[model samples]
Every structure is written in structure tokens, then in C-alpha cells.
Target: MKSYLAAAVQMTSKPDLEENLATASDLVELAVRRGAAFVTLPENFSFLGQETEKVKQASEIAHKSEKFLKTMAQRYQITIVGGGFPIPVGDGKVSNTALMIGKNGEELARYEKVHLFDVNLPDGNTYQESETVKAGVSLPPISISPELGKIGLSVCYDVRFPELYRQLSKQGAEVLLIPAAFTAYTGKDHWQVLLKARAIENTAYVIAPAQTGNHYARRTSHGHAMIIDPWGLILSDAGEDPGLALAEINPSRLEQVRRQMPVLNHRVFG
Candidate 1:
């Protein structure tokens, strides 16, 4: 009966940093009240307006928005995923980063998004993430103790690449975090399928928090923030709204699935 409760927070973030943080903080507080020991926010939870605005926010986020995350984690006495935000990395470019904060308000780990989104959609929208965001080089899976299990950190576009999840599973990842701002067109078509695939294939729990609704006139996200178990079962979903999805992470259930399937052990190709 021992289980860890986790929450995924969905949001429709605006261009205003203060407004976004306030909204996110309220959601996290709700999750904590619902018995969540680990809480996750969505991508661009601090700001989502124009590309230029993201670049500007990157330079100021460490002292401003990120500080808010640390304080919230401490106040709630819970671990938190700071979603994904842009951080300036010199050369006039930034890296889309996800941060983990401990219950004691200590910065645990940082994951910079490796796969940049450079695509043209059928909806006539295109994004060139590399134009302003630098890609990360490492692929190490981050782990924590009793609060959170071995965690694989990834951002929005990285969900398409199975190789990253495979590497993470190989490195002992029991929980996968995918914080995304997926376009409405693509997410409606592929989001659930991809999430279930990762969980079933890796035999790991998948926690995906997302940005929903229209941010500006042009950017609209498909938000079905969900938590999936090892057998590809959806535990909880926050459907197309700014809210929270709660689920229990049972370590024994994960072990049972792995024992039955053993997909990770049967892998032949890298």
C-alpha cells in the first residue's frame, strides 16, 4: 500500500511572468493539498508570448521566476519540477531547461533540452527552436531518493525521439517527465499514443504536464496533461484545461511490470 503521490499541472500561460507564476503556484498548492509529494508544472510556465520575449525572459528568470519555484518547493515541503523555461547560455542564445528542486529548496538537477523543434506543420505554422535555443549535449538520467525515483528529464519536442527515452531507461529511469507546449494540431493527433508507447516500452511511469489553450493569437496548445502507468494505463488526465492531474507512483507495481515483460533486458539494438 506504500505509494508516492504525484501531480502534473497544466496551464495556459500568458506573456506576463508574474501572472504565470502566480497561477502556477496556486495549482501547485492545490496539488499538495491533494496529497502530492512531487509536483510538475508545464513548459513555459513562467511566460509564453513571442520568441523575442522568451529570449528576454531567459536572462532574468534565474533571479525572478526560478526563485519563485525554489521558495514554493520549500514552503510546500515537496519536490517540484520547474517545468521548462529558457535560460541564457551566452552567444545570444538560450537553452530550454528543466529544473528539479528538493523538499528542502535545494536545486537537485538541471536538464537542457537536446532536440530543438525545427518543423513546418500542416497548419502553416513553423518553429525553429535552434535559432534562439542551444541544444544540450549530455543524456544522463537524473535520479533522487524516496521523494522521486530515477527520473528521465525531457522537454516538449523530445517526446518524438524514442532513443532518448531508451537511453534513459537503460540508465535506470523509473519515472519520465515530459513538460511540453505541444501545438494543438500535433498533440491532438499524437500525444497520447507517444506517451503510452514510452511507458509501455520502458516499463516506467510517464508524467506529462502541458500548456493548454491559446497563449497569443497564433500559438495554441493541445493540453491533455496525463499520468500513465507502466502498462500504458492513464491514471489521471487534465483535459484541455488549466488544472492538475494526480496519480500514485507505486514502486512495486513498476517492478512487477518489469518482471513480467523485461523489455529492457531483451533489447538487442542500441
Candidate 2:
């Protein structure tokens, strides 16, 4: 039970909810066919619209609210990380949330993004997630399976924070799930490097599913969905396409790396 198959679903989602879900379903089935026990979708796997207000309008509540996610999870019969969705929170603000679903379609955990992407890139591309998306207060990781080990969940922008991954690794997470919809401006420069850094420093496996290519008007995303081992080796990469990347995760590798490096035990912040 030391080895398990995992996958990341890359997509360029559109503004339509039904169309997005249909595409996601097809991708999940493809992952399953490729023998992935756990599959994760990219951020905004549900919808990537032209306007921020459109996202708010499409937001749905989590509890007994979003039928699309649950239906897909059960239908797939695999642990589906439903990427990040817009959930209505009261007062015109919504949470940029990620949902973890079990094989039986039960909700395992939900992590609302803490660090919102609020930057003005050099290409005159600017994003203000805080304009419509509200930040989450709690930080909780989800356990995929006993064999796969506990997985900490984080959205696109949260990858820039090392402290969060450190905390997750310290709390017994062997894998970190990063579902992103990164802009081409930033992803090309920092995506792979940052992902490898997190895996190396934290001594944990990192699976990142990304939105690639252009979606909607004047919006482009960098897509290179990948799965990296604990030793900073990239096992599989989707390479700028709408597809899946599969990797066999070895839990014992985490222990082996931790034993050799022992960095987690040597940390002391003054």
C-alpha cells in the first residue's frame, strides 16, 4: 500500500457552468482510465468568465448547495479535487474555495484561498481577486487516503507562501495539492521553480493542475500541469495542453528524504 496513482487535470475553462462541468467530467473519466486513484482539477475548473461580477453571480453555497461537484465525484468513483469554485458568502462577497470529495461523493474538506492574487504584472495585466472574492479564515488540510497520506489543499496564489506548506508538512501532510489558474505572465517565470522549491524544502510531493492557454477575451493562462516527487524530481508533466498527467506516489520516499535531510526537525524561528 505504499504506492498510489495520482493525476492533475488541466483545462481552459469558459464562462458557462454546464459546459465546464461536462469538460471536467470527461477529464476525470480520462484520469480514471489512466489508473489514477486521486485526481485534481485546475482552479476555476468550473468557470472562467470575462468579468469578476459574473463569477459572483455563478457562485453557489457548499452545504447541500452545489450538486454539480457531488455528482461528478460519485460518478467518477475517484477522489476528485474540484479545484476552486466561487461560493457565495453574504454581502456581495464570495469565497474562492476548493472542495475535496471522497470516492463516495462525501465532502472531505474545503479550503478557501487565504492569499488572493492581487498584483499588476509588467504586461499591463492586473488582477484584483479581493474585489469580488472574500478571503477564508481557517486553514485545514484534507486526507486523501491512508496510503497516499494527508494532503494539504491550497489555491493558485497560496503557492508563494512557504510557511503554509511548512505548517502542512509538520502536521503530517505528505502531499500538497495546488490547483491553479495562473496567468501566463507569472507562470512562465515562477511556476515550475516555485513548485519544485516547495517539494524540496518541505520534503513533500506536490501535484499542481493548471489552466493553460487562453480563456475568454484578453485572458491567457500558463498551463503545465505537473506532479513532482518529494526529492524534487518531476515525475510527470502535461506540458501546455488540455490533458492529464499521472504519477505513482511513493509515501516511503517522504520518510526517506526527511531522514536524510532532517530539515523539518532542525527548524527554529527566532
State the TM-score for model 2: 0.94
RMSD of 2: 1.9
lDDT of 1 by residue, 1-270 (tens): 247999999999999888998999899999999999999998898888888878877777645767988898999998899778888989888888899888898988888889999999999999899998899998845766755778888998899999999999988889999999999999988999999999999999999999999999889999999999999999999998899989999999999999999989999996
Give each model's whole-structure lDDT: 0.89, 0.84
TM-score of each: 0.97, 0.94
Q: Residue 187 lDDT in model 1?
A: 94
Best candidate (score: lDDT): 1
Flag regions of model 2 displaced more than 4 Å.
60-65
Model 2's lDDT to the true fold?
Answer: 0.84
**Considering only N, C-alpha and C atoms within 3 Å, which residue pairs clash in candidate 2?**
none
Residue 254, candidate 2: C-alpha displacement in angstroms = 2.0
